[model samples]
Target: MFLGYHILTKFFKNGELSNDSPKESYLYYEKNAIDGDLQGIIQKLDYLKELGIDLIYLGPIFKSKTTHGYDITNYFSISENISSNSEEEAKAIFAKLIENAHKRGIKVIIDLVLNHASKEFDFDSVPKNLSVKTESPRSPQEERWQMSFLFWNLDDEDTREFLIRVGEYWLKNFELDGFRLDHALGLPLNFLEEFSIRMKKIKKDVTILGEVWEDEGDKLKNFNLLKKFKGNDAQRFTSMFDFATYDTIKEVLGKKNGSLLELYNQIVLSNQLNEKEFQLTYFIENHDLPRFIDICQDIETFYITLGLLMALTGNVMLEYGNEIALKGDQTIHNFHESGRVAMKFKEDWSEQEKKTFNYCKNLVDLRKVHSSLSSGSYELINSEENLLIFKKKTTYDEIKVLIYTGEQAYQLDKEYFDLISNNKVLKLKRGIYYLQ
Candidate 1:
């Protein structure tokens, strides 16, 4: 089968990697930046629990040189940069956080950066025969490609086995649930198959999510390629983040000029791959993209996007600040001003902001309570210029979603319960609403 209806995932980065926290900055990779400590994450477990987050896809925590731990220096150690603690203490604290997260019913998964390593990564640790070093290939993600990474030679059996052991080390050592393969596209399909075969043997239900991106025309082609990652007896990835769909959503909601019908059409296109065969993950913002509020430039549009994300049929992920509507100007090339905005604790928000954030809670709860919103089939009941009415229905449940970007009022043919405020209504206006 696939993920349960109640599963809600999140992209978690601890601390404010902004100029506001300057002392923790990396010497070479970033300036005017500071990193959040693992200790600080322990205090936020309750917040994630309250938000109904079932799984958290954490940023890289391996020993690294930057605020975002993608360029790992060591595979077996926690980054001392994240916390002032020694590596041992930092790792202990991380383990404690995972332990606590599991206790609160939240599974934890960190980025698995197997494609490359820091320029500073000690090649001495690698076998001489396996050290077929090469620069990271030219990529659309120029910032990463420009940074000069030491790419792994996956063709070498010793290298693949080394990486496999690295993944296994995390699973066997930490109580970690699984990993988000950093650049699954960079790894060979056979390697992914083998990695899955091994990782699953350690934790049968381990969640291995991949980050695979392809162009619009290649969307279905990418889906078919993802299918190859699985063998007849074992599966490779539980889900993958589809950047094509993410880009379409970003264009429509962010620029506020893209077609609503086109947006819905993208979801319908992606729905073809859903269920037992392939699962896609959707989000409003992540560490890599510009924030919803910043790009949309309108709070109302941001709210509408959030509702659509929750109501859609697929896996759901909330970037660190998305639940409270943190705005950022983060680009693929940089992250100083926006992407690294620090966590806003519950006490940090004003009553109105807190109330608005709780509205996010209600939205997630709606997904969990209604299989129709999560696992059900999606159908467009009606549509117009900037307004669309859709329904998600399964054998046991059904829910209607009304999302409007226009000011026009719409007439309803039947009364239904307002799933958000738990009220009843027979009419609708310019807003996002979920009903049963």
Candidate 2:
């Protein structure tokens, strides 16, 4: 049986993560960057629900020094910077947030940094032999410090047990759905397999999403490594964010001369390489890269890209504020911080922002209703220099998406229902057109 069977049955009808269901739609929120307390997050659950978000992936909430919270100091305590005045109060708020989310049928996944801890992590309690000595500075200007990898000494029983306990404590006590492991590529494969086994033992429905980014060549080579890590019982991870897709989308959409055929070919190649049993999460923007709006500038191009993302198969993840077209970059001193901005609620949004938000909301709703767009077989119907047309077909339905980036308008011969507007027949201009 699949490990997350309970979650699949409870939230999805297909018994798997598919684009047709709301369960696969993930919204990433940075606790520190967003303007809200733990209670504020709870209050916003209804807003997220309205956006068709079923899973909320929170950036590191553990005690940390940085605004992004990647440099975790304590795995057990909530960050004081983003939480209540007292640790006890913070725990209460965290518990309430999870409870409220579950009550609304939404799952919660928090970021976990297992590779390394903050400089202030209490390593005195850990054995010296378990830590790794490095000459490289911890930060840009900081002095070098000894860092302890959770399983640096693979045979160390103490470290293994400690990390396992940490994983279990959150699931058991907080009733959390799972974790989004940070820098998963740097961690040991053996440890990942073991950790998955232990976590499944606690809650079979728990989901584990890893962050792995690399070039196409390295990614293909690493697929073998991932398969081996899963071993006989594939329990390591439910899925990984599709960085390969992100790279392709970035290359084509970021530049003015990016080819539509080039983007189609890249998607076809990545889909061919994906493992049958595992799912790949797709996203246009995250905390790491520059915002999508900043890269694609034009509103028409932005809508086309968003439409393509919604049409693609697999779980779709949207960074907070992406719907509003928020712009920022890595050049703002702290690179990650530039991309991590406060959530822009609809109350204070401009006309353009409102239009973008509505467009995204419609796409999310469309994906939920159309199984072909989410879990169907894909085919490249037509590919040209400026226009690319693709079809997603399942047993029950079929969806054809036409993307036009050229300056001239294009007309369709047949009349088909427009998926985006839900009112008009198919007639293409210099933008994205979806027909069903």
- Which of the numbered candidates is closest to the native, going by highest lDDT? 1
Model 2 agreement with the true structure over 89-165: per-residue lDDT tens digits = 87887888788988877788888877667666655534455543323333322222234222233345666666667
* Clashing residue pairs in candidate 2 (N, C-alpha, C atoms within 3 angstroms): none
Tell me the TM-score of model 2. 0.82
The residue ranges of model 2 lying beyond 4 angstroms of the native Cα positions read 1-35, 124-155, 214-234, 273-277, 329-335
The numbered model that scores best in TM-score is 1
Instruction: For model 1, state the Cα shift of residue 155 in Å.
Output: 1.3
Q: Where does candidate 1 clash, by residue pair?
A: none
Model 1 lDDT on a 0 to 1 scale:
0.71
Error of 2 at 22 (Å): 39
List per-prediction Cα lDDT, in the order shown: 0.71, 0.67
